[model samples]
Target: MGEFEFLAKLRERLPPDGPQVKLGSGDDAAVTAPAGATATSVDAIVEGVHFRRGEAELRTVGRKALATALSDLAAMGAEAGEAYVVLGAPADLGEEDFLALLDGMLELAAETGTTIAGGDVTRAPALTLAVTVVGHAAAADAFVTRAGAQPGDLLVLTGEIGAAAAGRLLLEHPALAAELPESTARELRRRQLDPMPRLRTGLALAGSGATAMIDLSDGLAADAGHLARAGGVALQIQADSLPLAAGVAEVAAAAGRDPIELAVAGGEDYELLAALPPDRLVPASDASGEAGEAKLTPIGEVVVGEGVEIRLPRGGQLKAAGFDHFAGPERGSQPEARERRGG
Candidate 1:
C-alpha cells in the first residue's frame, strides 16, 4: 500500500476515544488539549530527497528533521510543547546510529522547551524521519497568514538569505567550501543543518498589524509569490538590499553564481517574511528586537500589479519565480532562470 493508505489503516486500529487523543490522526498532527490555545504542524524528511546518507551526521539529521516541523509552528505563532516522532530506517543501519538520531532530536527538543511524549519506529528500504509538533499560543487569533496582506504594505524579511543553498553548494563541492575562512564555512553549514524558526517574531507580529506573513522555506521569491497570490497583490523585492551573510559574495564569485539569484531563489532559510502597514513598520523592529539578533530587514513593498517582480538596483526588474515542490522533479531540480530586471 501507499504511504497514506498504510497510515490510514494503522490509525483505524486505534481506540475510539482516549484522554491523550482529543483529536488524532488524519489531520496534520494529533492534538491533545493543552493548557492554552493549540496549534499543530508536521514535517517529513526523506533520505535521498532531504539529505545525503553519509554526508550528514545522525544527530544533526534528527535535529534538522525536527526543526523543519517546528518551523511550521513558528509560522503559526505557537510556542512548542510536545512532539511525536515517527521514523522509518533501512535494515542495514546500525543500532548505534539509530539511537544517536533519537538523542540528537531529544537534545534539540529539550533546548527548545518541547517534550518528546511518544514515537513509533519501523523498517524501510530508505530512511525517513517525520515529526509532528504540538504547541500553544496565548490566543486563538494570534496567528499570521498569507491572506492578510494589502496594497501599500511594506514587505520585510528576517535574517540573511541564500546561506543554506550556498552551504549545500559547498558540501557538494568541498574545494569551493574550503576557499572561505573556516568560521564562515562553519556558519553557513550550521545554517543549513540547524535552521532556527522565527517563533518569537511570529508571535510578536501576530495581531500587531502584520498584513500578511509566511516563513521562507521555499526561496524568498517563491514564498513571496505565495503571499502575493494569496493576498491578490503584487510584491516587489529590492534585489540590491537583500542581506547576505559574510563570505556569501566570495562563495558566489567562486561558484560563478549570482548572489542575488541565490538570495532570491535559494530555499530553506526559514526566516519569516511579513507584510505590514507603513505605520506598523516601527513595531516590526520592536518585534525583531525581542529576538536579540534584529533579524528583520525591509526588503520590498506591496503594490498594485499583476504578478510579483524583483527590482534590481542597477536598472531593471526580475520576475518572481522559484522552486515549486508540486511541479514535479524536473522543475524543482533545474536552476531557476534569470530574467531581465523589469516588466
Candidate 2:
C-alpha cells in the first residue's frame, strides 16, 4: 500500500488518545499536557544492525522497537505517556506487513497506557524503526537518574540477564539449539525478540528510595560502568551474585563461552538495575513483589571509587564488554582508558 493509505490505516487502528495527549496523529505536532515532570528518550533499531528481519516477524520487531525505547523511561522511574514513531519501510514491504507491525506496537501502547501521538513513514534501504517515548512523574526528583548513586548504596537488579544475548546466539547459530530444551530455547529467542520494559518495577524502586537507576540494554558490565561514571562512584558487582536466566549457562557452554561473561557482556536484557539505600532494600523488594513484577536481587554495592569492578567468585575480575552500536558485527570494547575507569 502507499504511504498515505498506510497512515490512514494506522489512524483507524489507534485507540483513543490518553489523558495526557491533547491532540493525536495527523498534525504537525502532538499536543500534550504534562502533570508535573517529564522524561523523554529516543531509540532506533535497524534491520541488519539491530535485527535480521528474516529471523523475526514484523509484529515482534514492532514490539521490540517500542519496548526498547520505553526502557529508558522505565530506568527513570517514569510513568509511560506518549510515543512518537518513525517507520522506514523497505521497497519490498506490503500492506499486510505494515498493519501487522502497527498492530504489534498498538498492542504494547494499550498495555502501557501510552498514546501513539505522532509519527512519519519513509522509504529506506532497510527496515528501520525509531521510537520516542515520554514518561511522567510527580516531580523531577521523583525520577531517578544514573548520576544519583551514593557511596555505600546497595546495587539491585530486576529479573535476570544474558537471556537476550543467548537468544541472539541461538538465532545466529541455530545448531546450538540442540543444547537446550525446546521450551528453553524458544523462551530465550523470545527474550531477544520481545523484551518487556520494567515499568511497574521502576516505579516501585523509585518510590522505595532508589537513588540511581538504569536499564540493562547494554549488558550489566557496560551499563554499570555508565551508572558509576554518572555518579562518580564505583560499582563492585559479585559475579556469583548475578541472576542468570535458566538456559543462559547451557547456551553459553554450547557456544564455548562463559555464562558469566555472556551475562555481563551481553546486551538487550532491558531489566532495571538501581542503587538503593541499605534501609530501602526490603521496601524495594516488597514493592516490586506487590507490583507482580520481576524479582529484585541485590548484586553489589556502590563505593567511593571510580570504575566498575566485577569480582569473580573464584578469583580475578571479569573483563566486561557490551554491544557497540557503531562497531559493525565485530563489536569491540570501549577504550582501554575509559574501560579501566569503568566508564
**lDDT tens readout by residue for model 2, 1-343:** 9989998999999889999898889888999988999999999988877888778888988898899999999999999999999999999999989988899999888888789999999999998899999999999889999999999999999999989888888888899889689999999999988999999999999999999999988788889999999999999999999999989999889988889888888888999999999999999999999978799999999999999999998998988687555454345653311211011
User: What are the TM-scores, per candidate, against the unseen true structure?
Assistant: 0.85, 0.95
RMSD of each: 6.4, 3.4
Model 2, position 167: C-alpha lDDT score? 88
- Winner by TM-score: 2
What are the per-residue Cα lDDT tens digits for candidate 1 across 192-285? 7777777777777664678788887777888888899989889888888789877777778888878877767767888888888999887778
